[model samples]
Target chain A: MARQQRGIRTRRTILEAAGAVFDEHGYAATTIAMVLERAEVTKGALYFHFPSKESLARAVLAERPPLETVPVRPCKLQEMVDVTFVLACRLLDDPLLKGGVRLAVDQCAPQSVDHAGLFRRWADHLTWLLRQAREQGELLPSVDPRETVEMLVGSLAGIQLMSRALTERADLAHRVAVMWSHVLPSIAVPGLLPRIDAASDRGSRVTEDLG
Target chain B: MARQQRGIRTRRTILEAAGAVFDEHGYAATTIAMVLERAEVTKGALYFHFPSKESLARAVLAERPPLETVPVRPCKLQEMVDVTFVLACRLLDDPLLKGGVRLAVDQCAPQSVDHAGLFRRWADHLTWLLRQAREQGELLPSVDPRETVEMLVGSLAGIQLMSRALTERADLAHRVAVMWSHVLPSIAVPGLLPRIDAASDRGSRVTEDLG
Candidate 1:
């Protein structure tokens, strides 16, 4: 049991080091040796987990922000906001997901990397949440869940990209907070606006609640 | 004078070829040899023009969509929509600007690429147009030009990225047309919405009119 647990921890450490290196040097420039140096693991151990740099990058790309950690909400609108907040907060420090997002948008990635899968899966998740919001009478009448998904997904992506370029995503949570202020007025029920918590710090609060 | 014109044309051809190569292979993977193969130019000539791959990429990043081709409009709101359509239309075929957009979003680029400059310049342009719209009484009383610029710039970028990932940007003009439909309602004066020329093909029409 201890051996298995140690193996799991080693795997996570390698992934973390890969994310940090990818974030700093990009997927093409990052080397296995760099990851090994940061991770302080033997190359044989590294190869035991990931066979190639491409596989390592693909694995990092798959490490999406932890969306499932949030407790389910009755108000689905609040649930959606919490999802955004939590992801933004996580992005501030979690090199894995942050680097994943960078790699997803990176046009330099090899043809084999499944960049579109991330965006599509995110759309699927957001689509489900928005649908629930609409069913509960929380969404505006003109709101099409698909259209909302496109706008929300695209805008959030752009906002984060811009934030990263401008501030190294230092103010991502705040920019996302600003995005919600613009978007909610157009989509959410006016009466419920006051109750929704789209605050920049909602992510930390939710994490604290979970912790 | 004829020799000067020919030199200018060769420079343009070289830039075009570089953009196409960069679009396909990305900055890190692209080689001057591949550009020479695509450009059918002598190595001496290519070297005389762009000294390095980094310089070539930077030049492409600087080759923004030709916003000046658009005629100034009486309604800055129409101008803004036209700008979006023109860019969307051009993105369908212009390898240079499309490649520039790709490079700008690519996180794998080396540190000297200056990706943020493109976004910042675009914002400056949009801010000027939106300020004009507000001055001409075409903007909503509640709309802040800076806020609108941030939303428009980021959302347009995101929409284009998503459209590219999904359809190779075949539907970008149409998607941008849809974007204006969503955004204009929240910012434009209600009376001016009817007059805005935000159709999907407005880009082609405006281009043909100029031609």
Candidate 2:
């Protein structure tokens, strides 16, 4: 068990180092030697966990940290906002998330892996939340959950990308709040509007609460 | 003057070929030789027009085709929708626009050129249109034109990208129309909402009318 734990720790360290390198240089420009150097691990050790750069990228892409951290809330709409906010906050600091998003959207490395899976997961989660919101009478009757899910996913992706391009995502949480402000009015029922906190600070608050 | 015109035509041909190649293989994988093969131009001819691959990518990034084509409409809101629709249609078939967007968003080639110019131009134009809409009493008094412009530009980019990734942008017009449908209700005045045509077919109709 001790040996297994050590192996896990070493694997995690490699993944984190790889994430940072991938975030900086992107997929094609990134190399295993860079990851090994950053990780300060022997080539054999690094290869034991991740055999190739593609697998490392796939591992980085598969890291969905924010999803595991968001605590459930009574108001589904609030939970949805919290999810986006928390993700935005994580994206700001987490190399893994940043690298994953870059790899997923960057058209340079199409053969790496199925980047669409991340988007599909996000859409599915948002759809489930929207269904819950609809059941709770938080959403307007005219809202199509699926369409709204796509818009939410797509718009957030764009906002994050633009923010990253312009400011390296420094104001991502704020931009996401602005996006929700523009979007909520069109989809949320009037009764729920005042209750849902879509503030820029919500992410920090949620992060603290989760901690 | 005739020699200069011929030079311009050759440059245009090289740019078009470069755009198609960049759209397919992205900036990193693309080569001058691939472009030469695609354009069927000699090394001397290609070099005479574009100094390097970076210059060709920059030229493709600098290509602003949609702005020149969208005619002014009496209703500013209609014109805004028309701009997006026309852009969506053009994006469906135009390699220049596709490659430009790809290069603009791909962070892999950060040192190549500043690709944010295209996004800024789009936002500036949208803001101008929103201002006109405000003056004509077509927009909600509460709407912030700048914020809406960013959202419009960012969301459209995201939508087009998602469409491209999922379906090779086959349904970009429909997706863009859906975007406007969601956005128009929040920004447009109630009276103008019914008049604004955000239909999928509006792109083809507007394209024909413009021609």
Candidate 3:
């Protein structure tokens, strides 16, 4: 049991090291040797875990959706907003998630990497939450959950890409707050706005509960 | 004079071929040899026009903002809408523009490529039109132009990226139309949407006028 725990710990170390290197240099420029150096692991150990650069990248990009792990909220609409805010907050500190995001949007990745599939998964997650919002009477009658999904998912991707350029994602939560401020009027039912926390610092506030 | 004309045409051909390859293989995977084969130009001719791969990519991405050559419209907001439509339309047919956009979003591009700068230029262009829209009273009183710019520019990029994944951009103009359907009510003054052509075919109609 102790040996198994050490193996798992070593695996986590290698994954984190790979994420940092991929984030700094992107996928095409990254190599297994660099990850080995970053992890300070024996070549045998690194090879035992991630045999190829492609596998390493795939592992990094395969983070489970935050909604699956985070506690469910009373309000589905607020939950959707929280999901984005949580991601925005995490993006600032979590190199692993940030690297996955960069890979998801990366055009320069090899043809075998299904970055498009990542976007599809995100749509599915948001779509499920949005349907719940509609059933709860949290959303406006005019909102089509699928359309809302595309706009919300894609716009968030764009906003993060833009924020990364403008502020290295330091202000991502604030930008998301700004987006929610504008978007809620169109998607949320009237009088629901007052209950929603679209504040820039909402991420920090919500994440504290998770810990 | 004939020799100079031929030189110009050759330069255009090389650029087109490079754009197609870059769009197909992305910036990192593309090779100058592939471009030369696609262009059917001698090594000497290719070298004369472009000194390096970096210059070739910069040229492809450096399409002058279309607003410079396209006719100005009577309504600034409509003009802004048309800009996005025209781009969506062009992206389907113009490999060069498509390649440039792919590069602009490409994380695997070399550090020197300045993909971030492309997003900045987009913000500047949108900012110019949005201020005009506000001055013309086309925008709502509550709208902040800069904030609106970030949302519009980033959302459009996200929409395009999603459309590419979903349908290879075949449905991009329609997606943009749907986005406008949702967004216009929030940003535009009451009674203005009736005048703006946010239809999916707006791209074809607007570009026909340009041609």
Against the reference, the lDDT scores of all candidates come to 0.84, 0.85, 0.83
User: Can you list the residue pairs that collide in candidate 1?
Assistant: none
Q: Which one wins on TM-score? A: 2
lDDT of 3 by residue, A1-211 (tens): 9999999999999988988888877787788999999999999999998889988888887767565655688888888888889889888878787777887777666657677666677789889999999999898888999988888888888888878877888888878987887788888888887898889988888899878
Better of 1 and 3 by DockQ: 3
lDDT of 3 at A190: 82
Alpha-carbon runs more than 4 Å astray in model 2: none
- Give the candidates in order of DockQ, highest first: 2, 3, 1
Q: What ranges in model 1 sit over 4 Å off?
A: none
Task: Output the TM-score of candidate 3.
Answer: 0.94
Cα RMSDs, all models: 1.9, 1.3, 1.9
Give the winner by DockQ: 2 or 3: 2
Tens digits of per-residue lDDT, candidate 2, B125-205, equal: 889998999999998877999988887788887887788899988888888877777788889989889999999999999
TM-score of each: 0.94, 0.97, 0.94
Candidate 2's residue-wise lDDT over A42-149, tens digit each?
999999999989899889888875775688889988888899999998887888888888777767665657776788888899899889999988888889999888
Candidate 2 Cα deviation (angstroms), residue A173: 1.4
**How many residue pairs clash (N, CA or C atoms closer than 3 angstroms) in each of the candidate models, in the order given?**
0, 0, 0
Candidate 2 clashing pairs, residues 3+ apart or interchain: none
- Candidate 2 vs. true structure, TM-score: 0.97
Model 1, B54-157: lDDT tens digits are: 88888888885687778899999898888878888888888898778777777677769897777778888889999999999998888888877877787788
**DockQ values for all predictions?**
0.57, 0.70, 0.63
Every model: iRMSD? 1.8, 1.2, 1.6
